[model samples]
Structure formats: C-alpha cells, structure tokens
Target: MVAGRRSGGRRADRGWTDDAARAGFLGVRATILPALLALGAAPVPADLLIRGAMVVTGSAAPFTGDVAVRGERIVAVGPRLSMRATRTVDAEGLVLAPGFIDPHTHVEDQLLGTDARARLLERFLMQGVTTAFIGNDGGGEADVRAVLASAAARPVGINYASYTGFGTIRRAVLGDADRAPTPAELAAMKALAARAMCDGALGLSSGLYYAPQRFAKTAEVAAVAAEAGRRGGFYDTHLRDESSYSIGLDSAVEEALAIGRASGAAVHIAHIKALGADVEGRAPNVIARIEAARAKGQRVTADQYPWDASGTSLVVALVPGWAQADGRAAMLARLSEARVKAEMQANLRRRGGAEKLLVTSGPIDVKGRTLAQIAAARRLDPVEAAIAVITREDPAVASFNQSERDIRAFMARPWVMTGSDASTGHPRAFGSFARKYAVYVRERRVLDLAGFVTRSSTLAADTFGLKDRGRIAPGAFADLVLFDPRSYAARATYAEPERTAAGVRMVLVNGRVAVEESRLTGVAAGRALRRMPREGTCPA
Candidate 1:
C-alpha cells in the first residue's frame, strides 16, 4: 500500500508519474506548484499535511505537531490541526524543520548546461538542503544576470542564489596582473559589483587567496565591497590567507573584519579555519578577534564545512600565485625553473607535509593516495611528485591541515553557521550537513539538535537575507526537510565521496516534494531566490 494518504480536492488521475503525483505520492504537490505559494495568495484548498513529526521552530524546543502547507507557504503549523488536506504524510518518527540552507557552495558544475545533470541537484536534497548559495570563492560566473537567468530557464531541485565574484570582475577588468588597480579599473570592478547586487546578488564574494583577487589589495576590496554594501548586500569572502604561509590566520580574520568595518557591509567569512601545521591550535585567537569585531558593531559571521581536510587544486594549495600570475603556461614555465620550483617546494612543505595532502581525483593511478605515499611509489620527493601530477592532470587534493579542536571551537560559536563549499572531488559536497548531524549533534553532543537545526537553517537564511526561510512558521516558505532523527547520518567519505546520506525521509522545495523515501522524485520544484533589491528580501 502507498505509505501516504490522499484526501484533497485537487486529486489527479492515477499513476505517480506526472508532476503532481511524482512530486509526492500523497497527491498535493501538483495543485500547489503553480496555483499556490505565490507572494500573496494562500490557495482555496490545502495542498499538503505532515502529521506527527517533531517540529523544530528555530525559536524553541521541538514540539509534536501538524504542518499544513498551502501553495508554497506554511499556512498553518500547530499541534493537531483539525483541517482538511489533500495528502497526509504520517511522519510519526521523523523530525521536520525548515529546509537546510547552504550559504556557501560551488554548484556551478550542476548549473552549466541543459543536461539532466544540471537539473538534478539530488545530492543537496538528500542532505536536507532546499536552498543553496553558489558562486563561491570567486569561481562563479562573472555575468551574474546570465547565470541566474540560465538556472531559471532550466530548473533544478533546489532554490539558488549567487554572489558577484571580485576575482571574476577583476580578471575581466584587468587581466591577471600583479599590481594595484587604477582608479578606472577600481571603478569598473565596483560597477560590476553594484550592478550584480542590484540585479539580485546576495553580496560580493571574493577569494583574495586566489589569483587576480590576490592581486587586489585590502583597500581595493573595501572600495568594491562598499558598493555592494550601498545596495545593502553583504561581503562574503575567502580571506587572503588562512595560514602562516603569508598573512597568517589571525590577520586573515582581522582582514575579513576590516572589510566589514570599512565597507559597512555584513562580512561572511567562507570556510573559516586555522589552516596549516603552523596554525594548528589557534582557533581561540581567531574567535577572540571575531568577538572583538562583533562587539564594535560590525555584522560579521562565518560558515564552516565539518571536516579536517579542505579541497582545492595543487596549484592553489601549494604553488605561489606569482608563478601562476599570467596563465597555465606561465605556471608550467615557472615549474620548469629550478630556483622557482625550489622556492614553491619549500613553501609547500611549510604549508603542510606531503602526508597531509591526499589526491582526491586526477590521474587514475594516483587518485586515492597521499602525496607522501605517491611520491614514494613514483621514486621522487613529494614536491617533485606534486609538480609532476599538476603538469600532467592538475588533480585536486584534500589538504588536511585543520585541528579537530579548532573545528569544535568554531562550531561552538553562535556566529558560525554551515556551508559545504561543496565542489567536485570533495565529500563535503555530499555530506557536510549530514556529517554535522551525525558527528557533532549526535556523537559528540557539541551541538544539540535544536542548535544544529538553527545553525544549519535559520542562521544561514537570516545572514543571507532570505526572507521567512529557516523557520517552521505560518507564512514562511514551505522549504522543509523531514528525516528519522535516529538514522540521519552522512555516508560520504573522502574515499567514497559520491555517496549520499541516509535517513532523509522527504524534502520539499516550495511545497513540492523533491525527495521522498530516499529517492529523487525527478521534480524540478526549485525557483531562483533573488535578493529583491528594493525589498532586501528574496521571494520564493
């Protein structure tokens, strides 16, 4: 028998293959899709009813209740609502909360083309994410309007937002140069940032650690960030340095705080960590600096992926940005030079020893081995081996530099939220949120269920200005995640990064069930969530 019961007036004919039925076997998603969930209308009849789940309202303890969704908003949420509904999900053993919102993600690979791959953002759904902000680390499209438009043309399974990347804008204005931007160049970058914010960007994002963005100084970043702030958008950044290799972790934290202070924009530090062996136990210092900044009235927050290993290219993890300033050919030439190669190798060793770098994907033969092991097998030193791999395939690496103590310290902070930084070649793409639930909330108890839910959902929504999201309340967007609390755990690992989590019972995006019974319903229910400039809040 079908697990769910159907009772609503808009019931369709048999077969769960159609959009309405496919979205949920319970039979309410079809009517809810176009007719309901708009800005003002509430729909004539209720569309979905979820009963018996422990609802976390983001403001208090979990309560047993019934949640009634109409159109795309939760019209009613209370204990035992005596109302009629089309479909009822018997969520007796489940936990229902606002759908998880990932504020930092690299989902551009899943949005590029009209392929089925582009539309199926199932990995995020399984982890209970209904909305994700992509275009992180300045690797997202420079043409902000075009990227958002393209995603809308071909819908995905989750709501999406993007930030205008300072690196992309800088590269567009001034090729890969190692100098200060002229007044005109700075104006162009600021114009690009301002237009993107006005055109629906949540903020300006920068990876000052990466190439062209690295070339830009702190003052230049402030100028561009200020333009985004003028439109009331935030500044999200991967700081200039996270280790002793350059500016050091403490200064990097200060730099992020300085950006917020100087620009009058809320600053969100992406993937905050004290990276490298040199900064192994300095999370407390970093936390202190952030607290100091916050006390001074700067709106500063940060997001972290729950992992010790961080994913990036070998060139990014090790090679000096100067050698790679012009292009790949310049980098390759730099690698060929003995003096330059030696300097980079010394820096690579200083960054982290070879044993800490695990090859995630690249050449098949070296795919799962650490640089130390691969170097031993290749009959060369670790630095030479890494250079050779980059020369050949430019494989990605999981650089394990962060301390567990630091991770816990950051997680314990109220200002810290969740982000996967989900990318190709990293397990975080599939397992970040789930991993937090399984390990941090359940195993370690560093974060309780209520705190975990709040951190993962509402905090992210509030920080990004996603109106009415991250809460299980009436008039809020019906983006939700339902899962068996006992079984919610991430199965993805570095060795098996493609695996999805377990215990996600159902996921809804704007009142349509995107995932049910651990399966993708093939429902492209997500809508582009734009930061409505005049309103300063996105409409679903």
Candidate 2:
C-alpha cells in the first residue's frame, strides 16, 4: 500500500501486488500486534486516524489498511479500523510509511550559531525526516547534554538522537592531533564515553579517518565502544578510511568490525561508500566484507546517502593527515610553510585532484565552483587552491564529491540504510532524503516507491533499534509525513544548499503537527530516543 498527502477523501480500488499484501500482513504482525493488547474488545479513542489510502507499514506483510494513532503510538491498523479520533488524515493516492530516520548528521552545530531552532525545523521537516542522529564524523556536538538541553527547550520539527563521538573524546583528552593515545589518555577517553552515555548519548561514534580520531588506536576505540555496549547503545562510525588516503576501504571496515567485536556493541558504518572512478564498484567488496562479519553473528550494519559524490573540506583532499592535524589554526600555520605547502599539493592530486572536490559553501563567488576552477582563477595548481580555500575559509566550508552510480549501488544493498553524513558542511544536510526519492526513485526508477520508502524509513529505524517508529501501526508514535509522490523533490544543491525539499506537505513528531501543508508550524515536538535495555540483542 502507498499513501500520499491529502485531506477529507475516500478512494478505493487501490491495486496492490500480492507481494505488497503479504508485506502488509507481516507489517501488521510486527507493528500492530502490541496495539491489539490495548484495544482488545474496546473501541480505541485515538488522537488521529488516517483513512481511505494505501498504508505502507514498514513490515514484510503485504496489505492495505487504515492506521490509528493514539497519543504517540499507533493503536490500530487494519483494512477497517473502527475507532474514533479527534483528527483524521485522508491519505488517498499516497504512501503512509514510517517516518525516515537519518543516521548521521551535523545539524547540531546550528545551535552554536544562535539561529538554530528555526533553521533545524525548516530544514528537516520538509524532507519528512522524523529523527536525525547528530555527532557525525567527529565534527560537532561538543557538549552532548548541553545540545540535548537546547534541543529539548527550543524544539524542532524532527526527533534527534546522538552518538558520543570517539573523536570528540580523543580531542578532549589528547587535543586535536594525529597521534596515538597513551595508556592514561585512553583511560580518560573511556571515562568521557561513560559520562556521555550517562548524559543520554545513544552510543559511541568514531571517525578514524579524521584528525584526532585518526590518532586513536583500534584498542582505544574498542574501549569506548565497550562503554556504549555496557549502556546498551550501538556503535556508529565513520570508518577509519573509506578512501585511498591511508587505510584502504576494506581495512577501514576491518577496524570498525574489530571495535564492534571486541566491545560487544552493534557496529554501524556511517555513510558507507567508495568514492572516485578508480574505486568504482568497490561497493561490492565493502558490502561483502561487512556481510562476512555478519555471517559470524557480529552486529554490523551500514548507512549511505543516495548520492555518489561525498562532500567535505577541500583540504581533506589536499593535505596529508600529518599536516592536517592540530585543527584549523594548525592547518593555516602549515600552509605558510614552503615544505608543507609543496607536500600538500602533491597529496591532493594523488588522492583525486582538485576538480573532484566541488565547493558547496565558502567565499560567495566560490561556493559552487570546484577546487580546479578555484585554482585556475588563482593561477595555481589544484593543490594550492585547496590550501587557499582552507586558509581562507578554514575547514568550515563545504565540498561536494561523490559518485552517483556508487551511491545507488550502495543504497540498493539490503543491509545498507540511509544517512546524510552531511551535517553543517554539506548540502545533504537539507537534501539527502528528498533527493533519494526525487532522483533515484522517481527519475531514475532505480527502485520502486515502496522500495525507496522502505530503505529510507523502515530500514533505517530498524537498524537503529527504534522500536516505536518506522511504521504507521497503531500504538506507534504519530511520527508521520504526507506528500505527493509525483511532486516530491529536493530543492537544495551545493550552490543553494540550505533550501528545503519541494513536495513534503505535512509532518508530525510525537503526534503533533510540526509541519502542515509544506510549512513549519513552529512546533518542536521531537524527542530524544535513548538506548533501551534489551536481552539477546546486546553482545556479551
């Protein structure tokens, strides 16, 4: 069953395939079974009822039916839900699936800029994302509790979760340097992880490829992962290396797997992909490695954006890890050194060249231009251009660099879910989800509507162990999105990255209408989803 946004309508003869019906049946069992306990022999007074449309519950079951939302949970789901509700959404000719959950993002940095609340809600709701996981690639969310406090007070359109970044912990202890942690530094890092989890962090996240985090040893990362495991949290990571920068892609996955196995936490590879033409089709190898670990009963999963090119600082391509360390100030200092400048230039070309890194945001004129173009204007090589951009804008600017083919191949994998990997630095922050539907599903026809929604919605929620979301079942939280499938599209790009998506009409977070008819209602009804205690799921 597929549902799109509309109100006050009754339409029938929604033809669903036999597979869809079977999937819906399975959805009912997985999503609505618990709701049956509360509504046994009693009429449910739900907060909202969505009727007369195909309801795509994110389950293996194949059936079309009505969905009842009671409070924050779905109370009933079936062909005909005989229940009363204060509000009803007519979802004719639309897909009513679970709200999508973005696994990695950096929007938390918006709070650092003051005008955060408005920016966050406007950016997220338009994409129909009910939840976003912050603290990605070891970039933002310096203080977990403080960020959560701000999120709780100001509110936004979507729910937010966090991973206590291993990189952040490393920085807090060892400073932002690319060096291994000493015995005491490792202990201090573990203490910080424990404190973060106590303060409501969902898990430990590591960006081994980035500075500070790169300095961390596998054993050190495993220690932090162990803390998250004790708290019943999962370990999400930006692998040590997905590029040819240093560790190969397979080696990076191995590092993440080792941490998961040693720490007893479910390991999730953040923004899993292989970049550049040289590494094209490396997706299959990466997936095969992850699968091999899964075959061993290890908890392993991966998330990928719908785009092929990834966005990051242009300096990431130019400067080697050694010179890139010490944060922005240290980088600027190194650029001033003749030796460092020459080495950095050679490094960038060796990695992928300046043309590959397209600037997303920086100097007004350079925003959409590529490093190669910027170099031409400056009468310098691409390497010098990268250094110039880093010197002028710092690592704060954005770049768009990923392959379209690689992105689709990654998303098509059963274990691969969705993640923007875009925080503040990239346009994916505002466009990943919508672009997936608009470009891949609608334009390219790479996946059907149901398949696309499942990858972005139900599949993501399940990977994160979010039990109350990802389906439109009764008793599930009223986290919902309404939009016209044909009309849905992403408006943001590297040039104009902050724009919201085009077709999302309404969004509800925790049974509250946070977005109505494609506009934000200034409602911050999102909640923090913490790791819950469970048995048989946690590794010993």
lDDT of 2 by residue, 1-540 (tens): 223222111111111011011234444543544445345534546677777656666664435567766655555667766667788878777656677888887777553236646545577778888888887776534366675666555645577777778777787888886777788878887787776766667688878877767877788788878987876677888877776667877788888888898998888888887855456668778888888999989878788887645766666656667776877787788787888878776556544666666776667757777777888998987666676667677444443345666777777877777778765546687888899888888888887777876777777666666655776654456788877787888888766778888888778787788778788887767765544333343334
Off by over 4 Å in 1: 1-45, 534-540
69-166: candidate 1 lDDT, tens digit per residue? 87776766767766578998999979999999899998877855677655678789999999888888876566767777765568778888888888
The residue ranges of model 2 lying beyond 4 angstroms of the native Cα positions read 1-45, 61-64, 111-120, 139-143, 336-343, 395-401, 532-540
Residue 507 accuracy (lDDT) in model 2? 81
Per-candidate count of clashing residue pairs (backbone under 3 Å):
5, 39
Query: Candidate 2, residue 393: CA error in Å?
Result: 2.6
TM-score of every candidate relative to the true structure:
0.90, 0.86
lDDT value for model 2:
0.69
Q: Weakest 10 consecutive residues, lDDT, candidate 2?
A: 12-21
Instruction: Evaluate residue 268 in candidate 2 and report its C-alpha lDDT on the 0 to 100 scale.
Output: 86
Worst 10 residues of 1 by lDDT: 9-18
